[model samples]
Target chain A: MTDNKYAFFIGCLIPYRELAYEISARRIAKKLGIKLITMPDANCCGLPIDPVNHEMSIALAARNLCIAEDMGLNIITLCNGCFATLTKTNKQLKKDRELRQRVNKYLADISLEFKGSIEVKHFIEILAEDVGIEKLSELVTKPFNDLKVAEHYGCHFLRPHKYLETENPENPTVLTKLIELTGATVVDYLDESECCGGTVLGIDPNIPLSLARDKLKNIKEAGAEAIITICPNCHMIYDLNQPRIEKTFSETYGLPVLHYPQLLGLAMGITPEELALDELRVKADKVLSRLVEEIKVKH
Target chain B: MSNEVKTYRKPLRIDPEFKNLVLKMPGGETLKICFQCGTCTSSCPIAQIIDTYRPNQLMRLAQFGLKDKVLSSKTIWLCAACATCVDRCPQGVEMASVLRVLKNLAVKEGCVPRVFKDFGSAILKTGFVYNIPKTRTKKREDAGLPPLSKTKIEDIKKLAEKTGFIDTIKGEESDDRQ
Candidate 1:
């Protein structure tokens, strides 16, 4: 907990819907020599607060940060929602001394304190920082081998202006870099950061479908092999809703959607099954089979 | 001679187009500092897929009184939540999170689209989403996969709801259901 390894905060989204995102992430991080230390009693990021328990949500997110702080470790998260919640809440406690006192007072009984010492980093940030890109590049047992990948930055990662992440918030190149390490190519999509329509799609399926259609059209026009993503929410929309979007828009979008971790797992030479190939809605049969066989050949 | 002064530019009552609920996350929201910069638009990937969807423009619209317009726009529903626009925006308008606030707002307002009704039913009736469509089950049986029964689907939905998953969208994860 003394900052040597990270306290893994597997946000709600991945566990509930985006399972592969976390599974592949765990597998890849293990391979990279970074240990994802987990907290047994980790609570919500309190992102669901503001709308529910405003004060309690603030305290809940702070509690998670404090749990990491107590262990003397930095909290690392994969989902953008978790990242925003943990980071912003931590930022809040630090900026407002009064709020910090109240939050600490609330947690006094739970034996947690927030002296603004705990650090929160996104999974991508840890990959870039702890596991040097150079080393990640070296471990490319299986290069993507010219696979065309379109990088998708989900809303939580890119928006709200304040989450100036470890990775370049704008013109992010790390996900692309990870893909490139596998000897694959990254394609530029005009709407890479555009909202996959957020949970708005949950209420009005049409809105997200059109947005996905717009995303697919650009990806298709770009002649990409797959759409790669990092956020679970974004991944959910793209993976679950893409087929419906295709039917509605009258466009044939067969592009397979991938989580960032899956792409890294492939480059690390893991088998397709290990990366949870079944999770992808638009199956990457060629992409998966080719990567698997290529890894076997290379090794 | 006294001249009467006339002003067509009325005092800015709430411009719904420009009306966005600024979520001041105890961190003094820097998102409000954005000044119509298009750096985010130039870099957004989803922007190319769906024309008329721009993070920067959406941010600007939220500033106007276009609450309904912003919430119901095809753009908000489609944001993939990639940090690309936030990364590219010169003004630091994390329009991404701003849109999330709008999304949460949509849920609160219950202003969901009809197709989106599927999500509501999924939430109210089942905690988990039904992936295999009824029409597609027959096709799956043709592929040698076992047929998905209506009873099995209902059971799954019942279990998810029982587990309080449906409540998660009523905006919850706790047993309290508050």
Candidate 2:
């Protein structure tokens, strides 16, 4: 277990924008005794450009993969888009020699090569698989025993079975299992497999915002104190867009969103400041205070 | 009741050549396999929210070679690429991938929406779709986090050049040019 190391692929979103996810992820990984060395010069996961140029997307992802292979460690990504891109790239390179040859030629010029040796895992996968649920619960000094949290397993975490095969695409219980380990009740909502609709925000924002609102309405109605997600894009859509959704629909649903790592960090007795919980757009103050009071009573 | 004769007209123009063009893309090879099952359309969240975004109709338009209509329609850009349709499609049609191919063609023909162009140009320049602003850096620093590492711009630039990223942004057909 001490030798468990991964080249942390801190994709463009987490490093530059989402500091709370970054901080909490780091804190949790440290607490769990996992070594996450930053991959040097890790570029974008090449998702934004995927729709524009498929070859370029593969090539860019190949470049990142080559960086990790050079270091002889598997890659772990925090963002779902990055997880999909890197995992897809690895799978594609392993199966298609011609595509690998073409991408390798581009990398050859830059003194890099895609040897297809290393693997890619999302942080959620690492937590769930490497850290078993029972062991994870043992590390929880403060649990959300009374909290009702809804798990938003974003689309990429399970779909496109050709590339990723972590859980059942239709009825994924892996996220639920992880949430339950925190001693919180996992609430089910309608359209659990529904896309967060953030991907088309550029095309027509109304639809994505509306989709977010509907999801929030369902989660609130299900009596969830907070929403938890693993992907940054999903977090942005649910947590960052809640106020906009409320304003658009003229409703007051103050549902706080938590990254799975943030929740895990809280359960590990990490201070809210260390987890950067205060940075969330939809405040988690009430939920955090409730958990804190529960811990105080136990003490 | 009086009976009035209704005239149904066929599609005025069909560009089978455009369909052939899309078929050459990596994931576009399965375009003709779609049987108009409507599974994709029904499964698409965006299609449910927006009346105009019907994946089944888009497939039919492509099959009918309605190149101009399909390429220029807001429907192609509206796909979230969530792969729900791809997973649900009975024929294994990669609907989202086909949409991407259409989007590429749209960009080549100068039919790209402003949002896509802005997003594309940002990646072309910064190797990232979004760049961190100064205020964001200050906030992170004040919170005691180290400054975000600067990307190796040249390495990314080289990869971008090889991929014809610049040409894609310029709306040129990079595949044939290379």
Candidate 3:
């Protein structure tokens, strides 16, 4: 049986830019009886520095793993980048004694060691595997039966399938299945598994913008009233940068982008205000109003 | 108009030992396995939009032991590290990891990008990639969220120092002076 307690590893992006994701995630996790103990003295997950120094990246990630090891809890991260980096590092250090000793040498300076006794999981993984869909379905008091949305898994969540080993990266159904659990219609769009180009946004903004434009176009054309994303970077590319993309392409696609937790939260009878729905760049009034109207008709 | 035909110049030299160097790195174990099926390039989202960035060509360049050409090229930095290439490679080449090995070599050669240097320094200072502003941290309480965890900067610095991250960035600074 999987543990209900987790060492919360809130990566840089969520605290810095994507508060709504964290806000909703904490709410849903609390509602599900998942105890989150804030990991103290956690550093960056080491993705940004991976390109410059692979060893250093591994060491940084190992440091975070050591913290969770100290806490005696499995690590749970909100960001896909953090989830992938930490999970890969944890698996690598566990299997490779040489790599572990190398990273442990660095950790020794900080008075820590990577025993690799703990596991790392993304928040969604816990919900699906530990919480179970039946429990989630039972908790839903206000299912959006008429809501239609597209799901973006983002690259780091499932790709590099060898390391992740979660779902088929080419045609992932985990996120789609989770979306369906909220009683929302999951619209199948062209190139459903495409990258959001967020990873390259720092190197070249135009590439991600073009990629987001195409995704938004496809999502819109498929009759999705909104787009759902689990990764903060993908959310930034779609929701935060949606206006920038529309302006650059001289097109119109004002599709609301919701964090999966926000969608699930709404389905569980959580109010939009509690989910921080107003913080979204593109207004979700259409989805929100539909929910309100559904309640009115029921009353 | 003077008819000046610009001749394409091949790389002056190739380091045959470079493949061995890549093979020694953590993610470079499968460097010799790539058969250049172009699956990675076709699967890449960045490559789909940016014609100049191709993963298979980079893999081929590294496989051929063209160290200088592969390390100094800007295209090596273009990989988003999405791992689509890594997953789709039928040869089990792990293209993303191989690209990271190339990037690490480039950083060692003092060809580090400005943004990466900024990221390194930021981590050293704040323990996070982007520094969380004090105002934002304070606002967390208003949002009914707990205070952000304070990172032990001294421990991070020690880890960074022991890993030679300090030296790598220092090496880049010295390169700038030259």
lDDT at A10, model 1 = 73
Query: lDDT values of the candidates?
Result: 0.63, 0.80, 0.85
Ranking of all candidate structures by their TM-score, best first: 3, 2, 1
Colliding residue pairs in candidate 2: none
User: In the order shown, what is each candidate's alpha-carbon RMSD?
Assistant: 9.4, 4.4, 3.5
Error of 3 at B76 (Å): 0.6
Top-lDDT structure, candidate number = 3
Instruction: Give the per-residue lDDT digits (tens) of candidate 1, residues B43-132.
Output: 665565545667776665566555655554545655655556666666666665676666555545454334333443542332223343
Q: Give the better candidate number (1 or 2) by lDDT.
A: 2
Q: Kindly list the per-residue Cα lDDT of model 1 for residues A1-299, writing each as its tens digit.
A: 45438888875566556667766777787687677776655655655333312355566677678768877788888988788778878887898898888777766656667888878888887777677788777777766655887888766664555544444455667677766776778888765655776644443456667777778888889988788888887788788777777777777878888887788778777767677778677898867655634443432
Summarize candidate 3's per-residue lDDT along B60-114 as a digit string, tens digits.
Answer: 7787777877777777877888888888788899888889989888878888777
Report how far residue A3 has shifted in candidate 2, in Å: 3.0
Q: Global CA lDDT of candidate 1, please?
A: 0.63
Reference contacts recovered by each candidate, as fractions? 0.14, 0.63, 0.83
User: Per-residue lDDT for A56 in model 1?
Assistant: 50
